[model samples]
Target chain A: MRSFIKLASVALAGLFSAQSWALNIFACEPEWGSLAKELAPEATIYSATTAYQDPHYIEARPSLVAKARKADMLVCTGAEMEVGWLPVLLRQAGNPRIQADQPGHLMAAEQVERLEVLQKVTRSMGDVHAGGNPHVHLDPHRLLQIAEVLRDRLMVVDAENSHHYRQRFVDFAARWALAIEQWEQQAAPLKGLQYVAYHKNFSYFAEWLGLQRLATLEPKPGVPPSAKHVQKLHNLLEGQSVLAVLTTAAQPTKNAERLARKLNSPAVVLPFSPGAEGAEDLYSLFQISIDRLLAAR
Target chain B: MKNISVWMAASAAVAFSSVADAQNRGRISSTEFNPAISLILDAGLAIYDNDEDYEIAGFPLGGEAGVAEEGFAINEIELVGSADVDDKFYGKITLGIHQDEGETELDIEEAFFQTTALPHGFTVKGGKFFSELGYLNVHHKHAWDFADAPLVYRALLGRQFNDTGLQARWIAPTETFLEVGAEWARGDAFPTGGSPQDGRGSAVLFAHIGGDIGASNSWQLGVSHLQADDVVTELGGHSHGGGDAPDNEFLGDVTISGVDFVYKWAPNGNAKQRNLKIQAEYFVREMDGEFEFEDAANAESGDGNIVADQTGWYVQAVYQFVPRWRVGLRYDQLDSDNQFSNVSFTGFGSADDLIEESGWADEDVKPARSTIMFDYSNSEFSRLRLQYSTEDSRHPGEEKDQQIFLQYVYSLGSHGAHRF
Candidate 1:
């Protein structure tokens, strides 16, 4: 009987050890979910918002609260980018591990330099992010920096998989650098190309590629374009040498298409993040964006 | 030499301006550490066809449950402040200001602290707050889709139920959403009177379950129960606008049970462009009490033992068919059954007169109303709405009241995110 009891204790210990290695990660957006997948292949991941959904205006659905309650770590693009709903979810989840300032809370935008930081902020400026533009994932250099920090975070949260996370980081960094080099060379001819976009969603991308954005479709940040505003823009750029009107798949295409038709240019729709059309992963996301731009030019 | 001197002047001007810009980058402001504060202003122009006293037969109203004043007026102004007190707790306070009979009145709408780091999916809240009795009761008036309260809410809950209380909630660890919560309140508010039972006048229990139906739809269903003891209430003296009627005092116990359901649909979980929301709630209440009235001038008096059963319901649908524009429709109704015995009266009235004066006479009229509204939001902070409603809850001989309201709500300063 004693030998049987010892055998039972051994089995229980084995089960506990196996469970510790399987971490649960909750990513606020699909881009971070993809990155987490690359780092910890064995862990379970859940992305709260998909590519088609706007991260800024998502609801704190019950399913999201459940996911957050069980999450071992949370990865988000924070600088108040998710100010609308993330706070409610965190408070409802009642999980101390993923609260702000904890080891399990990782905000990717905070790990790198941010662009478009405002000097003065007010509601008159529309829904401007005070900290900066939180779309830092579009810049390949900033993404690499965030990846390194995420790897370290993962190590701290799950120390048993430190070696695995480190090795994956080295591999991802090397491959990403090579892809950045190739993209730069391919995009060299597109320097100083003037364009118009739906929003400031592509600021980091345009800065990295030396593209000039003449204006945006929105009259102000987060405000939908009015007919008067659209007509005014048309009159301003009627006969100028504009390359194309660029927009994301998530944005409505009617305004962009109308403006593009008026300007006699193509309305190019790019995959804004992972899980979009032809953007199944991070690599394909950048590849498809550059490819679409080159094709449009 | 002349061209070189001009170039040097342009460079110097540019450098000086750049330095000035740098100096303006991060100025420290005096209100940096202040809590997030916001002010909401609600004003409206109301036109009604009937200029008589508003009363629903067989149901006495309490709290701020009444028809809007005729003509243009400021309905309410709400000042709210909220912030995290520390790592362990969050606190918020709201003050409501409104006009009352040519006088300005102020009331504390809510003041509460909620725990932030409670373990095992449990959270505790203390102080004064809105009771989670139904779906719409927890929301403020500014967040409502329409300008006025539903008829059922006005008749049964006195527009809404709130009190000084402590609440605890637990979220289950399930794939779908499930939550159970309970509240204990001082119950000095309407529907429960005088903080009875040693300051534990009322207790409430509620449970909710919800989930997403694919990417385009989501739903929630809830059930709640509330019970109060030793309630002492007054009904129908000055509110009836009849100078001869004496005030009736009620001593009783009350029990209320309700069920609420809500369904929302947005294409691909994106509500910015288009969405539809439908919600409904049904409640039943039982009151066992004694009613007494005395006419001092005539030395007339009355006393009776009474038992009443009341039911009310409202169903509403709001559709956002385009960006920044929405339209809604709501229908609500109320019914009551009253039984009186051991009735006696002196000098000026009979048992029937006592019953009629108490506003508990069963006239075979079920109060009901239908309302429709259209609104436009310029941004998240400002909205303008136009609403029309027709109600027939008055005495049998009175004509139905037709009402039209043009309302505007504007918010200033920082505001917290809305809860679903």
Candidate 2:
């Protein structure tokens, strides 16, 4: 009986060790965090955004640093979007898992189709980019691509869990594909729905959802709209019925309200991220944006 | 001075931190600790060769004031730590200590607490806080466009940053994210007086939302609004409040409003291609009081009551000519009418305010400056900058002064190089 008890104890120790050695994954932005959660429900998840903040300015908090310090995998958005602080976070996390060029580290952009390719890049074009556009996740195809990238990374950290990650990704993709079809069907009637937005951030979504590309609320990409620009937008859309003014939830509604009043339109606030106001999850975020955008009409 | 108090606190904290490290040393060897600490000590020697001698801060000063090399004089010690209080709260502090001009000053740079973990992504911080207003404002002195701050920042924000308050920031749940924060503080913005504000309150509300456009390219756009009231508004006026607002007689009723916009893009991260960043700000002010500008032609009690608007913008381009080497140039300009209040320099018989108000080619006594700078970043930790600046002030001879400063930065305490 005593010998039997010792065997059981040894087996229990091995079990505990296996659990402790689970693959460590670090997803940099919120969507990736949620996707990682969906892929590995039991794995420890470290996310930064919840429902109401900007991902670009997420503090590389100490807790994040501590998490990075031990991470065996790092996943993040690239395109210099995280440039202000991600480099510092990765360097300080003391974990070499996600260092650039490492197999364990991956930037989501490499997996997606680039848009808005700049033929001429110069200072004359206030803040020109060397790469095309970086906001790829607005397109589900890009997110699917990112999922594949993430799946490969998981495979690297836990060869045993590789099958599980791929399986999870497949399942997620099937559901995602179905959702995309639903979105297309729902947005079919809303094709060419005209609106003005505070930022060009929603362009990919607008394109995917079949929303018309009207004019931006801002005069330039990042610059505020002057009265003259507002007048110009009005002039350009003279023949079209601009149903509403749209902006992200994080944006102030002042300028949108002003423009909406001029056009006799309703000012609408859409969640740019999953879990922001109307967006409760990544899957529902796009659906709701397209659905509500049409409903607002 | 508050600087002395912060230094004392930092020293004590460092000593305490060492104790904690010694206890943790059992898990890790001291060999790992040595390199971690060396990041805290760096020194430099710079020689100043200004065309003229000057006095700043009402002190007996001269034009040529070059001391150490353009970077870290010595010992840029920083202690980064996080603490858990009970199960409900957690706090982080990044305290820095440096010896500048032989004074051991302490910067309680960043300290904040989170109510929850990364899941909620909500946090609140109170203490001497750093304003995330502009990119450069948030960059430590160790990382900057020049050895010193930009001219607009120094003149408008007073050398460092907006401080003396609590700020809360949160992130949204999406692949592309949005950030928003609000801050409240007691401080004077521009035109420093004999003392900083006492018991006055102001607020800054800001938000940034943008996303990745596609592969190899990413973009972000941000906007911030700052409003300050009941601030000590003494600019040789019987002035009242803060930024680009209108002029007043007693200045006790001016509200300064400032707005900022920023955009940045880089391919394959912020490197492997040219990276460009553009930032602009406009400040407008309004007052409820009458203006008593004795210098005004009208001489009306509310003569300076007219609102004043000012703007500043810079387009900087950085192209990595080769691996590990970058050359960049930035052109910055600021223009304002009634830059401060309706206070006229000739009225004060010193045209200094007039010189400071008008753009480069505007007022006879107007003072304005524009600069083009080229920077050479040796590595993540060191940089050398050569800037040629031209000041076309309302004042004839004092309008222009130019210099090239070599600034080098050495990081101590394990701060990592940032990548986009």
Candidate 3:
């Protein structure tokens, strides 16, 4: 009977050995999930929030907590973007390796230069991120910098895979640079094109493409657009030759549709991150966004 | 030479002012060290058939049991401050203010420090905080779907189990969500009464296990045990004969065990637009000891050896049918069985003699209630809710009381996410 028990225990341990060899990664958003996948293809990646969901607000399901508990590394966009949900998950997971100040914790925003950083913060400012806009992944230049930081983080957490991660980082950086140049050439016609947006979701993207954002549907950040605000956009469109009304996949399209109809312009829907319809990977995400914008124009 | 000196003076002033401007920018950029703070405001208007004196049947009024009057009232105002104390610990403080008996009172709801760097997947917390006994005890009131506490929670734990205590918990290194914890409390809350002898009155042990069912559904199950010693409880009820206060005193130990289950479903693992959650908890309490009751009319005391057992359970289901709208329904029931024998009442009149003869009821009194709620939230920070409930406990001839409440909750600043 003792021999049978010993053999059974050995079989159980062998079954779990496969999982133990792979690095378990928990990414707070889809952008980080895609980056982690690119850097460590052998790792088991779990994305907490999808592309079609607002990353600002998400429910911390038990499964998410469970994932965080066993994660070897956690990659996320910090600077208060996940201030609402990530802290609770970390506390509940009780994993010492992935705590805030640990080597396994990597925040992308901290590694890049943030835009629209505010000096003083108050509720009257309407949910403004004090660390500036956390939408840094939309800019390919910032993504390169964040990629380097994430690669180093993975090396520190999983030393055995340092060479694999370093090689992946070098290869990804070279390809990303080449793709950025190609995108720049293709998007030359979109420069200085005036457009209206549902929110300030793609400030970095607009800044990179040199597109001019004339107005926003929401009069204030984090607030739904009112009729008066939409009407103001309509009045502005009457005088200016705007290209399109731009919106993200996660945002509701009611205001965009209404504004586009009033102006007879196409409402351009862009993928904010990876895992959208045609943007299943990081490379395809930018290609689909640019193609949609160009088709709308 | 004079022309060259004048040019150098102008350049020096320009450089000095530029340096001062850079210093100002540096001061404004240093906001990283401040703690995260948040404030939540909840107020509502209520209408009820009860005349501010009606109490839920089979519920102890030791805690805040009375509801607001038929008018506008401030439900609660919560202020929270949290930050990492160091590399090894994190601290949080929550202050709650609410209107009670026409007076506003402030309570230190939770002030605790927890370890962040404990090895072996362990966490240790100390200070005054809510105990993790049942699924709902660790959650704040604003997180509830309905505007009021569930009937079972009110009867069993007095809304929450806030105590100054020490807790140690462990998260198992499993793929599934598995955790076990234990707490030693001062027992200044309900089910244990106020501070007992030496102030050590309650010990709680709990465990939870959860996992996902495929990709869209997740579920969790938990069990908890609370052992309270030497509970001197004052039963707040009316006498059967003369309508006077019964003032029954109970001196014994109480043991409560509970099990809770929660199931959630979100299509494609995206709950931004739609989701459904069902949660239920069942608890059973047993007490054994002496029960002494005062006879008001004859001014005599009756003593008996009483053994009582009580059970209560609540089940609620909430569905987010659309992005910003949610509806929920909840039902709860409480039942009690009391057995008393060898009662002796000396120098007593008719009322005292009647109480001594028939002190125990053969059948248990079961009280049940149901509530329904609907709410609309424009964002994660604000919500408007409307709720209605029917008290189904018919106390012989009393008509059923119906309640209506319209509430609004808005939270500003930074707040942590709620537990599932």
Candidate 4:
């Protein structure tokens, strides 16, 4: 009986070592963090920022830098979406493995097509990206493409578990295809609906659902709307029947509330990304966002 | 004529290949190799109750302390360019334009190249750059909360000191943030005057450790030491508290040691809307050498072997209750002590009387200043500030100087985010 107990102890030790040896993954946003969780459930994961914060701007805190330093791979929505802070974090982290041009650095936007590509970029246009719109994760079809690319990246960075990662990708892709059909059917009523948005964050979602963006509350991207701009928006809304004024959970509600009150329309706040406001995963994120839009009507 | 034709043909071939290359890329972009450029402009108006000339007693002044001449002035226009030189290095250049004595002058504030990819988390930088000795020296004038610099900084290091140097830093592989750096610089500035060749003038060693306290607070602590040879203190032209002029010289080795601490609180780790920061630093300087005084009227000289120790410190706190508004308060103080031996007077006066008249006979002079500032930022690129101060920075005997300032700072183009 003593010999049998000794054998059991050795097996438990092996199991714990395998768990400890899992790769460390650092995701810049919650969307990528949820995807990494699905792809590599056994690996340790850290999400740098939550959904309720603007990913465009952030402080490179020391805790985040520590995560970046020890990470085997870095995943981000990089089309200059995080132009304000990511470069400084990467530089300060001083981690060569996840630097640009390396396989460990995977940018989801690079795997899919982009919209609003500007021919002449200028600051007067108010913070328009040179690499086009970076909020492509909302498009289910594009997310699948990004998932495939990320799966391949994980294989390249952690080849010891390439077989396990590949199988997970296959399962995730098959389930994601079925879910896209369901979401499209559910969101059929949103087509041709006109609405106002706080910013261009909902461009991909609107494009996928066939919704018409009549006007923006913000004067420009990343710029707050002045009183004159808001007044102009109110005048436009008076002439047309609008669905609602849409804002994200990450944004403050004061401007949208003012617009909604003037227009007598319902104000809708949707979860812009995963891991916030009951949108804990990719599937639930779309469900919650579509349901909120429908409920506003 | 034959050789000229041959050269022309070669040039024509070179131009043809370049055009072909451009066509192959399928674009006509002129800024492909251009670096990131930015410009910062600072303009301010100062109102002073007493316009008498002012200087910190027992300290040498070499930086901008004139405070805009008590009227509307164009403080500075700073232009910066930065880029990655290659996969392994980065380069930055800054030019500052200011009005001095009714003439506009341009100065290169910083020009440096730093390595990005080095083994063992090591990085090296070389060129003319601000010494990362204190909390505020690395930050520019536009980034300051108040319109004017702190009294301690103006007295201890002449507002800010930048030198041509080489620095090497290493980040330890640990959970916390730990960085250790050393610099070898040309000590041709105030507080440290020596040769620029072979790095014999000045050397510095510094270390900083930082970490987070849960999700709401973060803190950092730093200590530094700087040593230089053949230091000279020149304070002839600067008048302190309505005092007469005396040509004074201090000679010997100078050493300065400093300690700094910073603590920041941001509720739920979201600093965008609200936050509070407290920062403080203490500096002590020692000069072991001789003091020489010259009477300009009689051409008489007095000499004494003296050792001087000077200390200064400042504490400041800033709070942002809303996204676009902030308020800050700062207090600073300076103290000095001089011990004299082997005193000799070659002038037509007694040694004690000469020392007393020259402002070195006293044990030490302590002066302090307090300031309050409020600023409104419409965006990250621009800010307007109002500041008021009650200061007795020149001498302990003089009454405090009441001052007010209104300033504006604006930035245009691509400006990179600063480190915390």
RMSD of each: 9.2, 20.6, 9.1, 7.5
Best-fitting candidate, scored by TM-score: 1
Q: Could you tell me which residue pairs clash in candidate 4?
A: none
Quantify all predictions' global Cα lDDT against the true fold.
Answer: 0.83, 0.53, 0.78, 0.78
DockQ of 1: 0.22
Interface RMSD, every prediction, one decimal place: 15.7, 18.4, 14.6, 12.6
- Per-residue CA lDDT of model 1 for B166-251, tens digit only, reads 99999887888898999999977777777888888899999888888888898889999889988876565324544554656678
Per-residue CA lDDT of model 4 for A1-297, tens digit only, reads 999889999989878866642777889998999898888988788888877677875777667777777777899988777767787787767676677645567777755677776778777677677667888888899898778777766666666566788999999999999999999999999999999999888888889999999988878787777778888899877868788898877777788989988988888888888867899899999999999888877
Which lDDT tens digits does candidate 4 get at residues B1-420?
113343345325532343244234333222353688889999988889877676666664545544555789888999999877777877999999998658899988999998766656677889988887877777888888778877777776767777788988887877788888999998866667645344558888998888888767888888998888776666443443344556766778888899999888876566766889899999998888887777666566778887878899999999988777899999989888878899887764787665655555433567788999999987778899999998876654666788988999999877777666
Predicted candidate 1, C-alpha RMSD: 9.2
Ranking by DockQ: 3, 1, 4, 2
Of 1 and 3, which scores higher on DockQ?
A: 3
Model 4 regions more than 4 Å off = A1-21, A226-229, B1-33, B196-198, B233-237, B240-248, B293-301, B345-364
Ten residues in sequence with the least summed lDDT for candidate 4 chain B: B22-31
Query: In model 2, how large is the Cα lDDT of residue A120?
Result: 55
Task: Tell me the native contact fraction for each prediction.
Answer: 0.35, 0.05, 0.39, 0.17
Give the C-alpha miss distance for residue B297 in model 3, angstroms: 10
- Please write out the lDDT profile of model 3 over residues A1-297, one tens digit for every residue: 999999999998876754443688899988899999888887899998878777876667677887888888899888778776888888888888888756578777766777888878876667578778888898899898788878766666676556788999999999999999999999999999888888888888989999988888877777778778899879877767788898887777888989998988888889888877678988999999888888888
Model 4 chain A is weakest, by summed lDDT over 10 consecutive residues, at: A94-103
Candidate 1: list runs displaced more than 4 Å: A1-18, B1-33, B236-246, B294-301, B346-348
